[model samples]
Target: MDCNEYCELLPACADDELGAAESLRLEQHLAQCAACTAELGRLRALRAAVREGTTYHRASPALRARIAAALPAAAVPAAAVPAAAPASRPRWLEWFAWRPAANAGLAALTVASMAFGLTSFMLQDSPQDAMAREVVTSHVRALIADHAIDVVSTDRHTVKPWFNGRLEYAPPVHDMAAEGFPLVGGRLDYLNGQRVAVLVYRRNQHPIDVFVLRGAGSRKAAPDFDSTLTRQGYQITHWQAGGMDYWAVTDASAADLQRFSQAWRMASGGTP
Candidate 1:
C-alpha cells in the first residue's frame, strides 16, 4: 500500500483494530516513511489532547426540548415492520443502499466519531479526584462481585502470602481486630492501569477496600495528613508509605476512613 493508504490506516493501528496481516504491512511502511510516522504522531497527540483537555457540558434543556420536538413519535416497532419493502422509500435510504461496502465504511466512521465525541464528554476530574473516583469504582466492583476477599480469612499471614507470586510487590497485611478494623482478606485488584494488591477490612460492618500499589512518580515520605474525598457516597483516603501508594475506600464516613488510614500507617510503619 502507498503512504496515503498507510496514513488512512494509522488510526486503526493506534487503536489496535487492524488485522495481523494489515497491521504488519502498515508497520513495515511506517518504518521506512518519516512523513507517515509524523502524521501518526500528530494524530495520537490530537487524540490525547482531546481526552485530557476537553471540558464536557450537558445539553441545555432548550436544546433537549428542540430535539424531542423534531424527532418522530414512537409508533410501529421494528419487529412489526413488513418483511418486504414497499415500492416507494426515502430517497436518502436508497442512496445509502447503493454500495454496501461504502455504506459499511461510512457506518464505521460514524461510530468512531460518536465514540470520540462521547469520550471527550466524560467528566474531567483533577488528578487527586480522579484517583478517588477510581478507588470508589474498584471498591464497588469488589462488592458487586461478592468476592472482595478472594482468600477469605482473618489471618494476616494467609492473606499476605496469597498475594505472593501473583504480584511483583508484596503488600503489607495486618490484622487490626484490636483496633476495631479487622482484616477481612486480601485480593488482587487493578488501579491506574496496573495490577495491584488490595487488603480488605471492615469498619462497623462496612467493607473497606485498601488498595496497595507501587508508588508512581512521587517518592516523598507519606505526609501526616491523609486527604479524604467522597465520591458516589464512598469515602476515599490516599497516602504514600514504604514506597507504596495506598487508597482506602469505604461507604463509611470520611472520619472513619481517616481513622482507618491512620491505623494502617501506624501498623505498616508508614507513620512519620
Candidate 2:
C-alpha cells in the first residue's frame, strides 16, 4: 500500500479495528516503509502518554453519606434497631440509613462529576495540540539546516509544476512579489505520514516557509491560524485553507507574517 492509503488505516490499525486482510496489507507495507513505521511509533507513544496522564478518582464514603443525609427524610430508609435498643438512642437516627432513592441520586451525581472531569482532562490533553507543537518543532529544525527546500527556484511556474503527480492535491502556489512577499521556490516534505508540498517565500529580508498538506476537512475556504516561537528563535504561524494545512514559518515578527498570510489568503481566494 502507498503512504497515503496506509495513513488512512493507521488509526484503525492502532486500535486493532481493521479486518485480518487489511491488517495484513498494512503490516506488509510497514515492513518495507521505515517512515510509516516511525509515524506509528509516534502515534502510539502519544496515545500512551495521554492515557498515562489521565486521572480517575472515586467519591469518599463520608462525602457520599453527607450527600445522602441532605436528601428528603422520606428518601432514606429506616435503620435496623434491636428490640432492646439503647434508651439514649434517638428515633430520628434510625432514618439515616441508605435507601434506593439515595443510591440512585449518588450514582447520578457520580456519573455527572466523572463526565465533567474527563471532558476537562481531554480538552487539555488533545492530540491536535500535541501535533501542532510537533509541527512547530519540525519547522524550527528545517530552519537551522543549511538547505530548507529540496528544490530552489525563483519562478512560481517552475515550483508549482514540480509537485504535479508527487501529491494527491494541488497546493496553492502564488506570486506575491507585487505585495512585497515574493515566491522563492518549493520542496517536498513529509508530515503526519503524507507527502506535503513546502513552498518557500520571502517578505522583505524575512524568509517565510509555507508547508501545505492535504486532508483538511470540509471547511476549505477559511484559514485556521496557530502561532508558536521555535527553539531556534524563529516564529511559526500555521493555518488551513482550501482543504490544505498551511504552516508559515519565519524569523519575522508576527505582524509581518499576519500581513503576508492575509495577502496569501486573498491570492488563493481563501477567507482571511
Candidate 3:
C-alpha cells in the first residue's frame, strides 16, 4: 500500500482496530517509510494528548430515562416516528397503527439486521473478548447501582481482611494512595462462574476496578499475558501476576490505566 493508504490507517493502528493482515501490511510500510512512521507517532501523541486533556461525563439516570422514554423502538432509538392522529389512542397502540405496512417492513428489516449483527459478533467474539465485555458491563453496573464497594476504606489492612471468608481465595490487597491509585474499597462479585474479589480504586473521579480471579493459570491464556481490552468506550488491562489474573476496568484513558496497573502490581508484590 502507498503512503496515503497507510496514512489513512494511522488512527486505526493507534486505536488497535486494524485486523491481523491489515496491521501486518501497515507494519511493513511503517518499517520502511520514515515519514509515515513519524506521522504515526505524531498521531498517537495527539490522541494521547486529547484523551488526557478531555473530561468525559456519564449521563445521569434521569437523563437516561428521559432519553429512553423518547424512543419509538428499542432497535432503532434514533428513528423519528411521527405523531399519530386520532382523538383518543394510547401511544403504544398508536405506534402500531401509524404506517402499519411501512413500520412492519422496518421492523422486519431491523430484526434481520440485528440477527446478522449478532451472528457476526458471535463469530468474532472469542472467550477473551467476552470476558472483557463482561468486565466492562460489571464496572458500569456497579456505578449505576451504587454497589461498587462493600467494605469502604482506604487502608489495606481493613479492606484486605474483609474478603477473608467471602471468597474462595485470599486476594492480595494493598493501600496505594502514595502511588496515586488510592484504595476505595473491596466488593465480592460473581464472574467467570465463581465469586471474584474486586478492589475499587480511584484516579481522580474515575473508578478503577481490579478484578482478581484465582486459579487463572489453569485457564486458557490469551495470546499475550499483558494486553489492553476496550469495549463500549471503557478500557480493561489484563495482566497475570503471582498466579492471579487481574483485569482492571476503568473509563479513564489507557495511559492512566497502564500507570495504575504498574503501580498496583508493584504494591501487590506481583510482577507482571
Task: Show how many residue pairs clash in every candidate, following the order shown.
Answer: 0, 0, 0
RMSD of each: 17.1, 8.6, 21.7
Tens-digit per-residue lDDT, 1-272, candidate 1: 78777878999776668999998898788656645654565466556767677654444556555544454433345677777854455556544343433434444566567766776556444567556656666676567657587888999888888988998888888888888898878888666657789888899889899888888632322443446777778887778777788878888888888888888778877662
lDDT winner, 1 or 2 = 1
Judged by whole-model lDDT over C-alpha atoms, candidate 1 comes out at 0.71
Off by over 4 Å in 3: 1-124, 216-227, 270-272
Higher-scoring candidate on TM-score, 2 or 3: 3
Q: Which stretches of model 1 miss by more than 4 angstroms?
A: 1-123, 217-226, 270-272
lDDT of each: 0.71, 0.69, 0.73
What's the TM for model 2? 0.52
Between prediction 1 and prediction 3, the one with superior lDDT is 3
Best candidate, lDDT: 3
How displaced is residue 45 in candidate 1, in Å?
23
Candidate 3: clashing residue pairs, number: 0
